[model samples]
Target: MKKLFVLFCLTSILISCKKEKTTENNDDTGTSRAHSEWNDFGLKGNVKSTLEYTTEEKKDGGNTSSVRKFENQFSPDIALKFDNKGKLINKISYKENGNVAEDIVYDGKDKMISKRNFTTATEYVETKYTWEGDKNTIIARRFNGSRLLDKEVFQYNNGRLVEHYKYDGNEKQANRTSFSYDDNNRVSEESYFRNKPTMQTRLSIEYDDNGNKTSEIYYDKNFKVISKTNSVYNSYNQMLTSQTFTDNGSLDVELSRTYDDKKRLITKESFEVYDNSKNKEEFEYDQNDNTTVWKVYKNGKLVSETVYKYDFKNNLIYQIVTDGKGNEIYNKQIEYTYDDNNNWIGKKTTVNNIVFYTSRKIEYY
Candidate 1:
């Protein structure tokens, strides 16, 4: 469900300029410059734009090498195009059967301005944005065929998002979120609401000197304690233990983690108030920091295990899971193709013999 929601915003794929810096400049042309942003996405840089198309096919169990299409699926056959700055510009969505569904356009600032739905054969929605100075903060008004649906007013402080207020069609405050940041520029507290000035939930967090989260507290609308979690870390700043307590001060859940000499997580054990079952998981990583194997245990006995394999480019290529007795439970294989810049341009995955493919067309400035 969370992944589906993120699809609408492409939130996870957005690059943070503050955390990235150019790493290399190829010759004097400036066209083949390499940067940390490329490494972040498993590419070799020089990428200017990208257009991704994704689709899937299910195998016909009755016949081998045969497949059929359906109307409803996990993701529509949508093409997402991003500019040189990695900002999404145009999104063309197609129905499961390959017919145009919608076409969305974004402005130079990467703000959605219009969306037309082919099925409806009309403009579904249009948005107008009013910026606040030079910051990314803006007030966005959404319209459904000239009828105002809602407006979102965003506030930022020192380049950090501080608050957002949403108003419904009637121009009444519908919901809002407020954030407070610590000295380290990390969010220290967050509050949510369904109505203006009325908080539904609030979360307060504390961190150690090493920037590791030390504690978190959840509060109800009335600021009553809902739950509290405390974390203990080793000298290496790795979490050694975590305990969560209920509002009544009862230990609700506890987790103990063990790490290898290289500071890699090796095992994790969990305990809960109701079940107290000995649930544990062990992990082994490859040289590339990828988890190569994972073992699950119950009552000190191994229940299942999973093995992962990656290609030379550090792409996960295969995964296999088996029961305690070594009976195969699940398996998947993936293949990929890369461009001259070492950027992945195509991907194919087979799960239980059902294939899915995703292809990308990239352009450079």
Candidate 2:
């Protein structure tokens, strides 16, 4: 089986903005302030990062297990410039740690072009895409290393995305994905296929009154339900309930949550994934209601636990994890600094005292 690690760090860097806000009160953020201050005062510097991972088995009646750590570092430099339309333009980023991350480019218009990426000692690699379009069609080129592989095409109506066509590494149409949107501009349904949509499976999405994602249901091409998920939320929009169903609409798994007066999540019950089904995960908070530790228990067995440390700004600074044997398996340390302009100018990451990566932000007027 394959696993996807959507690490918070990865998501934060790639996806900066949220599609919805839980409440208007939380909108008094300092993004604009930081941006303005950074612009007026101008900021430039370096930032660095590192990651450490570990896991251990928990034994009944035994202490937490020993923690073993693996670490890696990534560092980069960011420089900012402006285009004719006054839109910010990103130039080259030199990754000091040999990580060739994605680079963003703009045409000073509506299009954004992303460059290709190469790999390391792996058995395979891929280049990137080249696109050309007007108001209706987009053509993309795929490549392997320096060789052209295949092409992908997209057709749209008005500003609504309608269809996607993907080809092989050599430009053969391999798959197509079509999309449908609701009146509120939310993606209501989607279908995917090899060469075209299949009658086997289609997907639908739903949202609640506060605009929070409420559910996703997948149906076979025969219109028979395949799998469905239901979601619940708190005032902060944090997930409170998650229920999964099988084709017969039978509950396959479910989770529920509880929060404190400050709306901070305090505990969760998971009746799935293992035996003794009605296990629970507990979280403890500090005076400020910040989550300090999390614990998972199954049949009175301690399975997992984690502790977090935070800085004055409420930014996470460090994390520690352990198994039932009391072994420290995962430890991560991160720190950030800003200039007078409030621009985050530097970052540091470490795993068990081994520095993995760091980065600096360079700014220009």
Candidate 3:
């Protein structure tokens, strides 16, 4: 049920971005770069398709004895295909038994149009999307086979998402949410109505001169304050601290952060007022700005620490974790084989004496 709710929220949030003018040539390739999920994958080059899989080393006497155990043991776990413009078109995930577990399809514009999750050879759960003007997803519907389960509808005003409605399988409205923006075009208030005229809860937001969110106050239907959160920022507009208070004005939780001269976060701390408990995390970076060490503390005592090592190409090669007493608990080492494009095609990872090999097959345009 939680997974389904998350999928429902993702379908609605997909169209929340404000519409922007798309150009004919946005990249150096001179092709109109339509929306693509490839950017999120951190993949480089003009990729046409990718097949990824992993194999675990065969253990003997509770320990890996040789790398030869991994040979000829590969099984395709995921396969993805992209269009000429590098837009994802289709993706398939394989189950452990080598059966297709999920299949997803995207339109030429890179918008996900359909996703089907197979529960058996014949039964499946499917979600379909409908788009309106400017690639706006207007409706999303989920179905268990031929029976509808739920549906979401989105409304936009001047390219800004202004309202969202959820409906059950019977097409009866379940809930509605509306948004109001301030003069800066930022969302100033959010109202949620649970199939009622009065909002069940409303959140009011305020921003500072730098356009940073400064406060958020939540109120009940009777206009009574429920909780409030406030944030403070430094001159660089970096968040310094945030505090949340209950309706009675008692501090509930507080979080603070410290940054280095380069404006990179170096330390973060959190405190719970009622429990009187605190936690902190500190980080150290190398000359290349890569994190070298990370430490976690509970109530000012070290709990865990991790050390990182990277290669000249800035690829993480090794990392080790230890407990408070400096006893090694976890260790990972990676070896990479890159293609001419400097993209890793194969990698081997060793974790606590256990080995796993991952390979990627990439095709360029």
Candidate 4:
């Protein structure tokens, strides 16, 4: 579910970026990259992102806000970097100190044929990539500690993703997902599989005269409406509002959107966590659609608040999770310093000021 959702978002992002290529790779070994799923799903491999820690001083001297304490993150790096020929190139990774971790070779278009994590010593993971053409047809990401976590596949037609299947080794017959498009070359339907069509949750959609989504619905095998969503759009094709209904006919989620004069997303108000027991929480965003801050309330009484800050790379730099007393409950500070080797490093994080712990990471091939 995690990989699938990520792939779905990447596909949309790729399409939005308009840098996507059209090519398909057909291979039986499940290591090809010619399918649209890679563009949609992005890459699948045992990847790693390093985390580091340190300390510093805060304005209020009561607690040690200046240092990072406890738990530095460490993982195997496994990301594919391809070339123009659609062949896999080098697999890149980095350490916490901004050092070379690993550099694995790829075929063309940067599809990783093999990955070696850090001296092959004390390693817990490895991955292999395969492709047919420009599309990533299949791949496997594995970790060898105790057991396997996930494995998945993508099916494509020409240069478009048609289906995706995932297996947890245990689940209801490998959760399968299929995609389809309309004559306008726009996605028309997406179906979730529970092995067979008889066990499917299908989502069907319709477009309006302006190419804006008009209605979206979910249905059970019996063709009964399980849930539905309705959207309204302005003449400029900007979404004005969207509301979703649950399978039980209750409001599941609601969103109100607003755009700037430039039609860019300026603000969005959302409601989630339908506990019915707890007051439905609300969220507001900034002009950039960035969540500057959010508050949770219980029956009009504020409970918690979270604030965010982003870096020049648009990455989350810091987050403060606090109580209404303005007293800090939990906090996170991050600094990512990258290198040119495609291997990353110098990424830091600080947590729990009371108990100070600092950690660092450095990766090697």
Candidate 5:
């Protein structure tokens, strides 16, 4: 099915705060840290460096019935270096053979300044970013050796991104996007133009008095509505229902969710009008609000269930999945080794009796 909400997706990216930390906490390894301090890397406590690698047992076939062989040695996957404040400074990713695949560098402000991707032993692509005096990025240029490949230029209004333009290697305009904000400082409209000033598509958003997004409308170049989505929120500002309609005003998809008193999602239900299919998911959480059980139902019939087990430190240690008939389909168990700061350094995961190990060498400031 053709997704009619493409414009909404672009608006979201253009409106979000650039410095906001988008990374989720690492609960599986019990590595807990302040979001602001860790930024988007999710590092734990004053970490200076980290090297991660994994090892897997060899098997005759890629199936559970295959004969297991000796386990391979750990192959380096990634290496990261952080500054005294726990901000990532450098990162290197490796290929399966332990060859450097990509190297990325970040500035003091934790903004990525350059990335070099190794395509082969002698060939690479380099991309560089230029910021506008500690504000939004002004330009990004990609190069193949010394030859310019493409570039993007950004314009801002009072620190908010207002326009973005893309150009080909020859400096010819490829496309452009412009944004407008509402009285609340939220992006209320976005327009896209392809190689010309004529808008090809547009998206408009509406918000409630409490700043909750209430609806989004997609429009074509003629400003005719292509699709519309309406949302309902509870007193806590939690979205309770979202429904999308087609150009003809026919319901396309409807999603409803219920949350606990703590604002954690407890149940979600979705229906697709085209296929007449209904699906539901129920969630159970532990005292710490960690998800412990998840059950899926199709057309009101139970289909699958999953259970999660966590350690005393709130690190996920085990998980099992079963079919509706209660037959075990998948099982996994993890054993962790932690450091004095309670950060896990090593972990062994066994899935369906097949073992895989991952190790992390972390240096703290």
Candidate 6:
């Protein structure tokens, strides 16, 4: 599905901020002191990443598996530049075969300004974003070589996104989506269309007194009911159960959940459509608040189990998946190397002994 460009930009911004920080060199004298002081000074920085893979043969119990081997590693496939506050300003995505795929540039305000997508050695698609009036309204234009493909406009009202309209190259409206909110400032209805004045689908939602969602109804283009879902929540605003109904108002499926005192979900049971079978998922956490065991059951019979092991830093470093009767199906181990700042700079993973490695070069602020 085509995603909204603004959402993509927002996600990029978040990822840029959460990137792990490391040193440019291993020397811990002057270089280490400089990096430590830079953290106090709030300096701008960038990150470079490389990924490599290798295959190995392994025997678990009496079974064996073959792994696909890629001929080359993706060296320095991605480069990202960030501002002082860690907002993404520029991104260059490279193809697996070591070719530039796209270059995304962001404005000083952290809004994506333009993206260049490479189609051929000499051909490309260029998309530009334009903003107006306090940056609440945005227009995006896409071009393939010299030909315009489509244009889209996003509109916001009272700091809430309300509508998005898509137009053809000739500037004719092709599709649009509208959002409506309730008194509690929660989205109450949404409608979408593929062509002007033609409705495709609509969704309406109802909320409880505490502003928790209670029911959601979906409608087809012809205004016929497609499905209805009803949810029941506890006083803490946590969902306890939910039921989905078919167009004829018949129960289609149901789900129930149980949580511990920490509000962590412990068990989830699903009632299949038109079936009495109940599939369940159970979780167990360790002292570090990491899920150590995850089990899945079908019709009250254990089907599979996954165990997780973490390092002293609470970083998940090992995982083992087994079927019922304790037969190992998959195993993975991860190791990490940290920088002076205690940030992971290198990560290596081995799945059934087939190794994959990723290295990051981070400049700290």
Best by lDDT: 3
lDDT comparing candidate 3 with the true structure:
0.75
Give the distance in Å from residue 300's predicted Cα in candidate 2 to where it truly belongs.
4.9
Q: How do all models score by TM-score?
A: 0.67, 0.61, 0.81, 0.52, 0.80, 0.69
lDDT of 4 by residue, 144-201 (tens): 4334455677888867899888767343346788899998777789988786755478
Model 6: residues with Cα > 4 Å off, grouped in runs = 1-78, 91-95, 100-149, 168-171, 196-201, 220-224, 274-277
lDDT of residue 122 for candidate 2: 28
Candidate 3 lDDT tens digits, 39-157 = 44545556788876677777678776443223121223677888876777888876655567789887643577888988986678898887874555555555565788888888888
Q: Where is model 3 poorest over a 10-residue stretch in terms of lDDT?
A: 11-20
Off by over 4 Å in 3: 1-40, 60-76, 107-110, 120-122, 133-135, 139-141
Q: Tens digits of per-residue lDDT for model 6 on 209-283?
A: 999989999999989999999999988898999999999999899999999888888999999777788899998
Q: Which residue window of length 10 is worst by lDDT in model 2?
A: 17-26
For model 5, the superposed segments whose C-alpha errors exceed 4 Å read 1-44, 58-76, 108-110, 138-145
In candidate 5 the C-alpha lDDT for residue 118 amounts to 88
TM-score of 5: 0.80
CA-lDDT, candidates in order: 0.69, 0.56, 0.75, 0.56, 0.74, 0.68
Clashes of each: 0, 37, 0, 50, 0, 1
- Residue 148 lDDT in candidate 1: 77
Pick out the ten consecutive residues of candidate 4 with the lowest summed lDDT. 40-49
Query: What does candidate 5's lDDT look like per residue over 39-66, in tens digits?
Result: 4444456678888776665566665332
Candidate 1 Cα outliers beyond 4 Å, as residue runs: 1-39, 48-95, 99-152, 156-164, 176-204, 219-224, 234-238, 298-303, 337-339, 343-348, 355-365
Q: Which is the winner by TM-score between candidate 2 and candidate 3?
A: 3
- Cα lDDT for residue 297, candidate 2: 81
Per-residue lDDT of model 2, residues 70-177, tens digit only: 232222444444442234443344333434444445443244554444343322234333554544254444444455566667776767778888777677678888
* Candidates 2 and 5, the one with greater TM-score: 5
